[model samples]
Target: MADVATKHPMEDEVKKTEASSLVGKLETDVEIKASADKFHHMFAGKPHHVSKASPGNIQGCDLHEGDWGTVGSIVFWNYVHDGEAKVAKERIEAVEPDKNLITFRVIEGDLMKEYKSFLLTIQVTPKPGGPGSIVHWHLEYEKISEEVAHPETLLQFCVEVSKEIDEHLLAEEEEVKTPETPSLVGKLETDVEIKASAEKFHHMFAGKPHHVSKASPGNIQGCDLHEGDWGQVGSIVFWNYVHDGEAKVAKERIEAVEPDKNLITFRVIDGDLMKEYKSFLLTIQVTPKLGGPGSIVHWHLEYEKISEEVAHPETLLQFCVEVSKEIDEHLLAEE
Candidate 1:
C-alpha cells in the first residue's frame, strides 16, 4: 500500500489491444446430407478414408503415432491448400463419440509458420426434424504477430471436405440400401441379464477366454490361443464347442477389443460354420445396469451366408444365451 501505482489509460488500452490481437477464433456450421453417426465415424474412426472421399482435396492421411480413433494419437495429412500441396501433422487432442465431437491440435506443418498454436474441433449433431446432420467446425489459434491474417481459407477447406465426405457416405448408404443383387449378409442379436459386473463379464471374453470352457463345459469344451497374447487385437484363437448336438471347432481372429466400451469382436477364419456362411463375426458387449449391481450382456452375430438355403443362426444364438447364463452363474459363485 505504501508504493501502490495506478496504470495509465493509454497503457490499459494498448494491453487490451495486444491481448485481443494475439488470439483468434473462427466458427462455421455446415449442413451435411449424411447421418450424424456416419459423418462422425468418418473423421473420428476412419480419417484415412477421407482421401478416397475427396481425392482432389486430400491426398492421404496416415497414423504417425498411437492407434486410430484415440486421443493423443498423431496423424499426418497431405492435402491441397490454395492449389498448392501441403502437409500438416496433428495430434488428436480429444474424442467424444457420445457427443460426436473430435478435436485436433496442429503440431507441425505449413500453417505453423504464421501461427504459434492452432486447434481444430468438429462436432456433428443430428438435424432437427430431418434425416441429415449439422456439422460445426471451430478453430482456435494464436498468431506470431498481428500482421498475420486469420485462417479463413483453412475454414473453407474444412467445409468443402465435410461436404465431400457426406456425399461419399450418402452414396455408400444408397448402395447398401439397394444392392445390385440379394445380399447374403444377416445379423442376429440377443441380450441377457447377468448378476456380474460389466468389467468382469467383458474380461472373461477379452482376457481369459480359455476359462470360458470351465464355465460352460457342455457348450464350450476348450479354447486355446494360436497367436499373440490374450485380449490383444489380431490374435488368433481356436475354440472347441458343441452346437446342435455336434462337436464343432472354430478358428477365429480377434478383430477389435474396446475395453472402455466393454466390447469385443471375433471374426471366424476357419470353422464348420464357415462352410454354411462365407463370413461370420461375433460381437459381445456388456453394459452395467442402472441402479443395480448386475449388467446386461449383448451378443451380436453378423454373417454372410453362402446361400439363401443356409439357415439363420438362431440355434447358435440360443447356444450363446445358454453359455452366457452359465458364465454368469460361474462368476456369481466366485463372488
Candidate 2:
C-alpha cells in the first residue's frame, strides 16, 4: 500500500474497551399508587395489553414464538422511539413473579443495530407500610462500537411509559372497586409445548396417577390413591410434592374429566396450599398442535388467597412449568 493508516491512541483505547466483555448499565426507579400485583401482572403476563394503556408510546405487542406469560416467548413491539416509528424484537429471558421481576433481551430491531446486546428488566415491589409500589427499571447493554450514543433517550421513554401505565391502572382500579363487588379471586394461565402425543399425556395424568413420580420424581415425591378409582370424578388423590424448597402434601378431589377434550381438573381440598389459600383448583388441558405431531399442554390455576397481603401465585405457576418440562423430557426420552 502506498499509505499506511494510523489510529489515534484514544480510538485504540475505545476499541479495546469495546472489544472486552464490559456492559454499560442504567437504572431508573419510580413510585406509583397502583396495586403492585396488578402492575407486575401487566408486564409479566399481559404485555400485549399495554398498547391499550400506553397507546402514545407503545403501538402494540405481538407474540411471535411462545404463549404469553411463558418464558422463552418472543414478542415484537411496534413503538415510538425518539419521535420515530420503530420495532423491537425481544425474548422473555427471566420472570420472577415472587419478586415482581421480568427481564427481556432485545434480539433484533433498531436497538440491536446500534448495540451488541440489550437487556431490560422491570421489577415492582410494595412500599413498606405504604399504599403504593416502587417500580425499578434497569437496562444493561454492550455497544457495537464507541461511536454509538448512550441510551439516555431510551431511558426517558421508559419513564414516560411507566407513568402512563400507572395512571391507566389507577383509573381501572377506581372503576372496578364498588361496595357490591370486592376484589377476591385471581387466576393464572400458562402453556408449554411438549413433543409428545396428546392422548398419552392426558391418560398419564388422568388414568395413571401413580406414574407421575416415575416421570418427575424430583418434583413429585409420590402419589397415593386416597379413594375412588384413579381418574374418575368424585375420586380423591393425594400428592407429595416438593414446592418452594419444602416437601409438602396436598389432598385434592377429581372434579371433572373430559376424554374428548383431553382435560382434567383437580380441586384442592386440604393440605399445605389450603393454609394460605381458601381454595385452589388446577386444570390441565392438552391439545394437539395444529399440523404438528406434538401437543400443547395448557395449565390453568384459579385460586383465592386468604388475604390481599399475601403474594400472587407466581411461584406455584413456576413450579407447574418445571413439572411440565420434566414430564415432557421424560416422554421424549421414551420415544
Candidate 3:
C-alpha cells in the first residue's frame, strides 16, 4: 500500500516566512542630460556601443546568440562592480521601443551563486519641458538564503554608468550642433508595387491630390487646397487623416513638381505634425515597371524631430503605403 502524505501544522507559516525573506525588489531613478530616445536605442539596438561611452563600468558587450534588439537574444557583458571585475551572461526578456524599456534576466553570472534568479530593467523618459531625460532602473531578485546581502552595490554601479553615458552623449551632440543644421535628423524610404500606370499614379498625387480622399476614404478623410493652384510649384494643400488610431492633419506646400521624372515633393509648413517635428518633407516618385503591367511607387520621408521623446515617423510612412494601395485598387477598378 502507498503511504499517504500529511501536511505539517507549521508548513504554511514556514513557506510564508521563506518567501518574504528571500524575494526582494529594488528600484532607483537617475536624472540625465541626454536624449531619452538615443539612450534607449543604444541599449536596445546597439549595446556594443556602450563600452565606448562608459568604459570604466562597462568594459564590453557581445551578442552570444540571436540578433540585437530581439527577445531571447543572449548577451555577455564585462564590467566592474564594487571595485572588482565581474562578468554577466544575460538573456533579453523584453524590448519595448514605444515605452523606451529593456529587460535583461541574468541566466549565468556571479550573482547566481548567491541568488536563485535576477532580473534587471531600464526605462528612459524625457524630462518635462526640458532638454534632458530620466533613467529608471529596477531589479527583482530571489536570494538562495536570507543570509545573502541585497544587491545595492550593483544598483549603484548602474547609476554611475548611466551618468557617464549621459555625459558622452551630450558631448557627441554638441560636436554635431551647428547654426544651420538641426541637432537630430532622420530619413526613411520605402517602395510599393501597384497594378496602376505610373502616369496615373503621378498625376493623382501631383495634379489631383484633392481627389485622393475619395480613393482612400478610410485612411484619408478629406483634402482641400490651402493655397496656390494645383499641379504647380508652391501650391499648398491640407490633408486630414487617421494615424495610429488618432486623427491628424498636415498643411504641405508643393516644393517641386517634376513631370518628366514623375516625382513630386511636399514640405509640411504647419499642422499637428509640426508640433513634434521641426521640419517634415515627403517625396513621391512613380515609375513604370520594366517587365510588368503596373508601376512601382517610391516613398521617402525626411524630418528633424523637435525632441528625442518624439518617435520617428514610421506610422506616417505606413499611412502613405495604405493610401497608395487603396488608390491602386480604385484605379484598377475604374479601368
Best by TM-score: 1
**Where is model 2 more than 4 Å wrong at Cα?**
1-64, 67-175, 180-182
Off by over 4 Å in 1: 1-18, 182-335
Which is better, 1 or 3, measured by TM-score?
A: 1
The TM-score of candidate 3 is 0.49
- Per-residue CA lDDT of model 3 for 1-335, tens digit only, reads 00111222322212223448788767777889898899998899878769889998998676666667799987778888888888788999999999788999998877889999999998888888989888887778888997998887887888888998898889878867756545458888766778899999999988888788889998888888978898789998999988888888999999999998799999999999899999999999886654348776878799999887889988889989999999999888889
lDDT of 2 at 232: 95
lDDT of model number 3: 0.83
What does candidate 1 score on TM? 0.52
lDDT of candidate 1 over 101-131, digit per residue (tens): 8999999988899999999988888877878
lDDT of each: 0.85, 0.81, 0.83
Order the candidates by TM-score, highest first — what do you get? 1, 2, 3
